[model samples]
Target chain A: MKFLKIIFLISITFSLYAGEYAVVVNKKNKIDKISKKQLKNIFLKKRHFIDNQKIVAINVSANMPLRMKFEKSILQMSREKLNSFWTKQHFHGISPPLTQSSTNSVKLFVKNVDGAMGYLPKNLIDDSIKVIYEF
Target chain B: MSFKLKTILLVLSVSLIPYAVIMILMGSTLKKEYTENTLQEMQTQLQLNVDRIEQYLKTLNRDMHFMSRMDVMNDIYSKDLDKRISYLLMEKKKDLEIEGDFYLFDKNYKIIASSNKNILSDSKKINKFIDVEIISGFDNTKIGNLILDFSLKNFTKFFSNTKSRNYYIIVDKQKTLFLEKKFSNALKVQMPLKNKTNIEIVLQEDKEVFQNILKEYEAWFYTTLFVGALLISLIALYFSNRLIKPIISLSKAANIITNKKDYSYQVDVNSNDEIGKLSHSFNTMITSMSNVLDELKAESENKIKLLQEQSKNEMLEELSSNLSKYLSPQLYASIFSGEQSATLSSKRKKLTVFFSDIVDFTDTTDTMESEDLSELLNDYLNDMTQVALKHGATVDKYIGDSIMLFFGDPESKGVKEDAISCVIMALEMQEHMNILHKRWINKGFTKPFKVRMGIHTGYCTVGNFGSENRMEYTIIGSTVNLASRIESSAIPGEIFISEETQILIRDSFETKEELKITPKGFKRDISLFSVKNENKKTNKIILNEKGLSIVYEPDLQDATTKKDLKKTLEEFITKLSV
Candidate 1:
């Protein structure tokens, strides 16, 4: 009966995180947590390194539903505004981010590379990667 | 082929050919219909199976979709949560009659939970995935993929209760997932399931059913044909026997007649049909031939008998003509003409009986040679007999050189005519004897025959006067004897007749002066006369036994007569002196 109450409390708390996404990184990374602004700056290639290591930020493929969700909840920018920003950054000899076709590939990239970070549905988090931020 | 066998074959073929054709046509048509109907039936059955399998696949996809939306996927952060998901999938698998495993993959590309509870093998990882959908929360946050290792048995099991002659197949895009069995030839129908499942259900029918039907039809067709032909043959043979029996018998009967040459044999008529009528006609012809043969035989026998009789009659005529030579013509005519019969009998009638003998024929015969005498005698008698026959005298018999004959008994005129014909016949015979004498002298006969004949008219018995076997047609009694006496008493070369004959012949003949003599058969002297010519001039001179008497007219004696009388007186006186 107490276990049932504990499950009920967990369900209540998870409602607060509804429509939110978690930014994950490999467990080997030294950063235990990260601010959404810094993560967005890293995904936009404004900061290329973190904790004296090179940072590799992963994005899902263009038009992927998860990628659209991640862009809306984390990047906080319209598609047209991001398209101009990436185009400006592409001229400055900086690529925006590396993209994967599915959330599974984004998770695999984060788990295998150090200092790498990606986002997925919050219910899809597993032990192979750490959530550095949530959106 | 013999006639009967050919006829039988003809009948069998005539009846059976059409029957076999019809049977074959019907059998083939029925087999075609059966094949079409069976194919249609199998197609409908395969469609029903395809529909059921499609529906079953749809139901499995629905189950899989419902299971994917369960609340356990949102507990990915909890410990032992993967084990809980696997247990829940196992429960669904039992309820849904599913035959394969289920797997739940997290967003990190790891199988977080699976119903198989084993490490992912390579072969198992290549399993057919059905209803691969995202597991999501109420916030539409993307979870991992829910994968069902879809079982084709659930699809193929729909046809498990079907016949052995059918198969069911399940196929996806790349490979055939499940099939009941392999099939080379089949009638296949495919049905794709509704949306989420990428599988097709196929139904197929084996070809052995149609092949079996064709074999059965062929066997039935040949069997029916054989039986029908046999029946027709037997029936034809029976009828041919019925038809040919009479003809065979007729030929046999004809052969018998030809070989034996007997037309009396008849064929049996057993029916009133045309063959029977033919037998009747044949029998009738035989009977007619037999009748004609019998008639011909009888006619030929009669002809032979007539021929024999005719030949026998010719022989009898030849014998009778020969015997008639020894008989008198009157007697021969009378007997042969059936007027007289030869018997020992006599009848009295007025007959002119004549008898004649040669004058001193014995003395003449003794002087002449026997051959000459016989020749002279035959000539004299043949001539006399001919003369007598001309005068219608019945010549009776010849006594040496004498002839005894009679007229007026077998045939005659009145008594006076009879006497005259007898005397005339005697005169003619004398003339004929003179001719014979002249012929004999020329033949160097020294002495010739002299015949004298006498005639008498009296009532004498003149008939066949001998035994029945040896008969002589002659005249008998005193009249015959007197005729003989008169013939003997007459002078040589003179014709003498009795007074009865003289009285009858007096008018036709002249008589000498009547003298009186007594014959041995008479009791008194009978007057006899020497017949002479009546037309001579009369100089009556009579010489009696003692004296001479003369009465002559002196005018009648001429000078030659006076001289002859003087010379005769001198010679007479001189002979008287001697």
Candidate 2:
């Protein structure tokens, strides 16, 4: 049991250090991966087409840990900074990406919709969606 | 009924019946027209409200479609994260004064942005009144939907709620909105929204409210009709009385004339109508009748006066006929024929007068009862008067048992003829006295009257002579007194004549000388002569003894009397022989 406990602790520590999340899209999308800049531009409504297909970006609810990680790693902005940016973009007739209450709903939305994109934990990603980017 | 009452009834019927009928018909027609017109006006107003609500709903649908097509709707691709589309929706809600909110939803059924921010989530879905899909501006792709939450208050600008009239919404023909209670007895108008067919707008009006307004109109109409009827009745009464007055007065006048039977009463004429003419004619008739009655009364009085005069004349004629019994026949004839007047007047003409007496009448009457003496004297004078009247002598008067007569005054022969009639009348009177003596013997009167007669012929005054009040128609001269004295000197049962009378009768009679004596009224002694019939038949036989006396006249007896006298004499002879 001690050995089993030690192995469980090591696995926990490795998972903490290497807990990766992936940006995903519908399996029918032509793209295998996405750049962080392209993701930022698509989510911010600046770039609308990718590989000749229109892009739709989605997010989990605010205050979600994965949403915070996505903002920190991909959007490269704090929550306050993103909110201020969207507030400014509202004046320009621009909107932020779509949001859902849970990561599962974000994943489901991205898997069913063409040119749809959302972020999820790598473990939760399945064959129904393609991994376009990782963090 | 009285004429006035009849006239009043006629007027009321003539005026009021038609008036009441017209009023009832007009009232009913007006009531129907008023109700229909009021309902039509209400329907028109409700239709106007319905049109306004339909216009409002159409505009709302158009506004939702316009907003969905706008560039701001691109924010739906970002799930309206910047709140741009929601801001526009909030502005439109404010401008429309809606009680609902607007929402934006993505393809995941997530609420992207909403005017009500708390509803912005994937778990919240709104029931929409208006919905439009958002398309991408760059790729022409549907990304999301813009929706309006259904609110009954959204139609408040088009509808104003009142006690009787209210507006409500019916969703899906099942749920009623914006209504406090459901009404069963209400008039309703409904129209569905053109954009949302399941939503309906309804307008309701209370039927009882309209009915109350109609009832008020009915009350006003009936009151006016009643007032009009009252006015017509009063006018009828006034005209009826005015028309009947003259006829009433005429009837009253006719009644008075019949009751009192006074034709003098006249009706008063007050107008130139037919009744006035009738009164005038009635007065004229009464006047004429009164005049006729007066004329009848005067004619009756005149007839009565004529009848009274006739009765008086008849009475006077009867009185004069009774007076004629006391006068001589000659004098009565002369007076009735108007030959002599009844006054003390005498005329001197030659009149022959004669006188006769019952010899020793006083001695004979003193020995008998007065009744028997009067009977015997009337019998002797009646015989003397009969002989004198037969010889045409007028009997003047009777003094006791004497008779005085005259001739040649009222109806005269010659003086010689008058004197001869007097002597003859005296001889006949003497002869009639014997018959009177025989009648007296049959009456058992032993003492019979012996009458003596005297005659004279001389001039005497004759006419009515005496005082004016007492008149006798007789001669009044010495010749009358001499004749009376001559009658006294004659022997019983003898005829005596004066010398003048003997001279006038000597040719027709036999005469013998008699004693001459001077009369008291004569100046010389009057020579007297005894006169007898010249052809006298002596058929009388008489016998007298100490106890028996008999006398008879054969020439004066009929056969039966002769037989009775012979039988009596033979019986007496036989008794004397015995």
Candidate 3:
């Protein structure tokens, strides 16, 4: 019973923190501003190029509020609809956006890698990361 | 395998395999065809018609959706929210011209607007609306529900607008209490139920027409399969019977052959195909085999019978030969001539055996004419043999001129008596041949011949000898040898008997003592006797008139070993008187 209570508390805690994600870009890159539509379009694989540079996209985990917001602003569909769509896309040899676990990992990835794009929470964002789009 | 068993198996399998396979295959195919024709096609067509009905329902549903979104309902909505709701019933009717009655309910499910004037009409159909509203709540984009009454009363009023297609609408959201047919006003009713209901759409012309077509197709499919199966079965059965007719007859013939163990049964010959050829071959083979078997059986029986008869004949011949050869001629010849003869059994009686041969009768006959010499010797032999044979002396053999005679078989009249008879017979023969000498003198024949006979008696196996093939009925043993030696040492007409014979005849003869004669197969002289009659002195006068009573020197009997005793006696008188 105690273990169950702990599990229940952990799920609530994850749910509370679910929507808190920050989009991260390389800190050294000068070009910065991006629209939510462009972010959504890039991550959903609907548009390939952004601001004349090929866009790189990433994802939050399944059922997370950030993934929901990402779907509404980008794919413009429910998660079930998105799943069915990706099922079709995978059949056609296309894969969805790359995902990462923690915002700190996204920040560290953007800092060390070129052409890498990802998201984390605002508090986890730092000088090594630049936010291109935030919701 | 026996030829018959192999043939039966071959024929049965040959006939049965294809037939069984064809029948089983036909039965299975017939069943398969029956199921496909009856159910599978119906299921496929049923799914097809169901899909058409679903399509129709979906299209009507879409059209009703478009009607719900029309401007006219909105125009009333754009007006008042209260008094407008009541007048809304009439106006809503005009607005939704395609339906029987149109009604509106607030989000709280209270009747707000209606197209029926029975102001209680909304309550009257409240059940239908309440059921529809409950289902509309969970839908995200859906606003309100709509119901269309397609009862014929209203349907006939708007029939001109929708006359292109024939359809029926049923509102089952509220339970149906009654239905009245427009054409006949005949009502059908059902048990009512509380709201939480269903809707049904019925198409009369197109659906019924299609249903009739489907029903007809079902009927046609079933009837066709039945007819086809029946016809095919009839045709197949007819052909099968026709095909098996010859086989049945053949089977009957085969059964007969098996039961009877006779190969004579044959199948009927018809065509020149496989079956016909088989029948013909069967007939030919069976007939030939039957003939062969019959002939073989007859031949074997004949051979057995013949062998049995041949064996029996051989046995008979052997039996006859045994009977003929094993019986002593002493008895046989006498018995053959029907003579009353007896065998003398001398258990302790003394007897003698005799054997003699001519010195060289073969050399004499070589110089003489064979026929003349034989006649001359036969005339001499006749008298000597008769005397010996007549008095019960067995004339055992003649070796040319010499006579070997024995007493004591074919009846022994006592050995002493036989000796006495033999001496008297010799004297009488000498007298009798003087007459032949005179007759031969008148005919001027050659000099009268002399022949000698020897007699001895002792123990001998005076019986038959040799095999069934060649037999000699005579005596055998040692006593026969002594008599032969004594006779061969004697002169013609001289009486020479062994010491055994001398002892037997002492009373009959005025005996002379034994004179030993040698070089006649004896180491010492053997006693021989001379018989002198009481008129011995006048014997020369009788001898002169007839011939001489010649004293036969014992040595002359040795020379004329096989000469007749009678002729030897006749010539002896002339020699003795000299």
Candidate 4:
């Protein structure tokens, strides 16, 4: 019981200090914002298009702290649960979102692809991409 | 060369040489064609393998291009965060069964996605066996390049290496891969990969392997040629023997015939070919020659028989000529003419018989040398015979120095003419004795011969009289005896004729009555006459006898020679009187 209390206390402390992240697309995208549910659907491959255009979702690598924070804050799932969900979705001919090793590559990916979107730290946002959602 | 050897050579030349040449030509042609066809097959196989390699490369290039164009390539912008492109590349590499890796490079030439995980994120160059541009699907722009690190082992699935055939890769005409063995005298084929220009597929087929097969075929072909040559030689021998056998026998027979001079030799005929015909013709020629020789022998024998007959006839002619001296010419002619038969037979005919005697020939021969006497006697008889023959009298016989003759027996003019011929012959014989007496005295024989002749014509038996083996052609009976008696009574140099002969000869000669005598068998005395030549005159008288020879020529003698002759005659008369 004491080991579980210490793990809960450390998680809450990390959540208080976590930096804000935004889901961004190329600057040429018309969309200004996205609902959290829509972002979830896009990342999970449940929704394939946005605003009548095919959408490509991007993610950070699995070992990234930002990826863990995003999964905790928005996916509301653990790493094991997300991995099992994507594994199940693979049978349905649906794939998880593309991943990048760093926030810089994630930003570069969203900046280059027109219908591509990816989450990044807010401080790393640049003029090459547009923020469609912030958290 | 002998006929058999010649024939064998002919057959071998005709049959074997051309056959051997054709066999060699065919064997060489077959080997050449087979080798060409084998090379062609090898080339076809190489081309098929090359085609498969090209097709595989095309498919690989297209697959690479298709993968590069996939929507999943959009993830290259995200650096394949989901590793989807790399997974696809690995799957293609496995599907191609290539011995190389597939890698996706970003714009900076950094390997972002690769089938080989160890090479992930490695920086690489654009040089590769095959490469394709990675285009972002949403932006429609080039993002990176997909490349393959190709290995020569990848062509192993298309072609494999064997003892006789080998496959390899040549890169840029310098770099050789896969099999590195150097091949000498091999068939080499190379083609560049369509997608990889620097890479070539090289196929080599070792010619030594095909050469080995060709050598085996050549050995077999030569063996067959040897066997064929042997068979041809055997056939040549058999045919030469068959063809030359008759000719050899013919030669042998010819030799035998030449040496032995025989024409009965023949050759055997066994076939209906030309040789058989030649043998038959040879036999026919031999038979014809034999027949001709036989005819020549027969003709020659006939010629010899004719020659012998001719020689016998010549001998007979010579013998008859010799015998003619012993016979009267008329009798010899009559016998030769087939008119007279030599047999004991007689005919009664009026024959004028003549008789002559050398008076005192015996007494003269006793006084003279036998040689001189015989010479004188032969001279006298020869002269007498010539005279008698001139008158056509047949001489009957000679008893010592006496000769008996007749006419009208073998051939006669009637009895009157015969008697006249006989008396004339007797007168001629007395006259010829005068010539003999002169010849004898000149030859140193002083004694001369005196001949007395008598003739009579009467019916007498005149014919061949004697034994069958020994016969005389003569006249016999009283006419012959009376003629002898008349001859004895004749003066030494006188001719006396009986009355019958006188009557017959009176017309041809002058006759005077000499005397009359009754012969031993006569009943009355017959008057004898002396015959004288009518045209001759008595100019001289010659009397020659034994111990008495008087020749008085009144006109030729001078008075002194006449007195000397008269003295010799008177002395001879005194010697005769004593």
Over B369-445, each residue of candidate 1 has an lDDT whose tens digit, in order, gives 79877877787778888898888888788888888888886766767677777877788777777788788788887
Give the alpha carbon lDDT tens digit for every residue of B1-578 in model 2: 87788899999999999999999899888878876675576567666876787787778778888887876665554455455666777788888777788887777667877777577454345667667787765457787888888677767666777787787888889998888556667767777766567777777777677667667877887788888889999999888876776676667766876787666777777778776777677778777886786687677877787777767767766776677656677777788788988887888987677787777878878889999888777777777777877877788888888888897878776676677667667766767767877888899897766777777777788877777888788888877877777778888778788887777766556788798898775678788888875433365543322256444557789999999988998999999999
Pairs that collide in candidate 2 are none
Location of the lowest summed lDDT over 10 successive residues in candidate 1 chain B? B542-551
- Model 3, position B500, has a per-residue lDDT of 62
Q: Give the lDDT of residue A95 in candidate 4.
A: 68
Interface RMSD to the true structure, each candidate: 12.3, 6.8, 25.9, 4.0
TM-scores, chain B, all models: 0.58, 0.48, 0.32, 0.71
Residue B352 CA error for candidate 4 (Å)? 4.5
**TM-score, per-candidate, Cα-based:** 0.50, 0.44, 0.28, 0.66
Rank the models by DockQ, top first. 4, 2, 1, 3
Task: Name model 2 segments beyond 4 Å from true.
Answer: A1-135, B1-3, B107-109, B120-125, B135-142, B161-215, B260-578
The residue pairs in collision within model 4 are A99-B81
Every candidate's DockQ is 0.02, 0.03, 0.01, 0.20
lDDT, residue B572, model 2: 92
* lDDT for A6 (candidate 2): 88
Could you give the CAPRI-style class of model 2? incorrect
| Predicted candidate 4 versus true structure: per-residue lDDT over B337-373, tens digit per residue | 8788888888898888888897888898899889877
Alpha-carbon shift of residue A66 in model 4 (angstroms): 22
Query: Comparing candidate 1 with candidate 4, which one achieves the higher lDDT?
Result: 4
TM-score of 2: 0.44
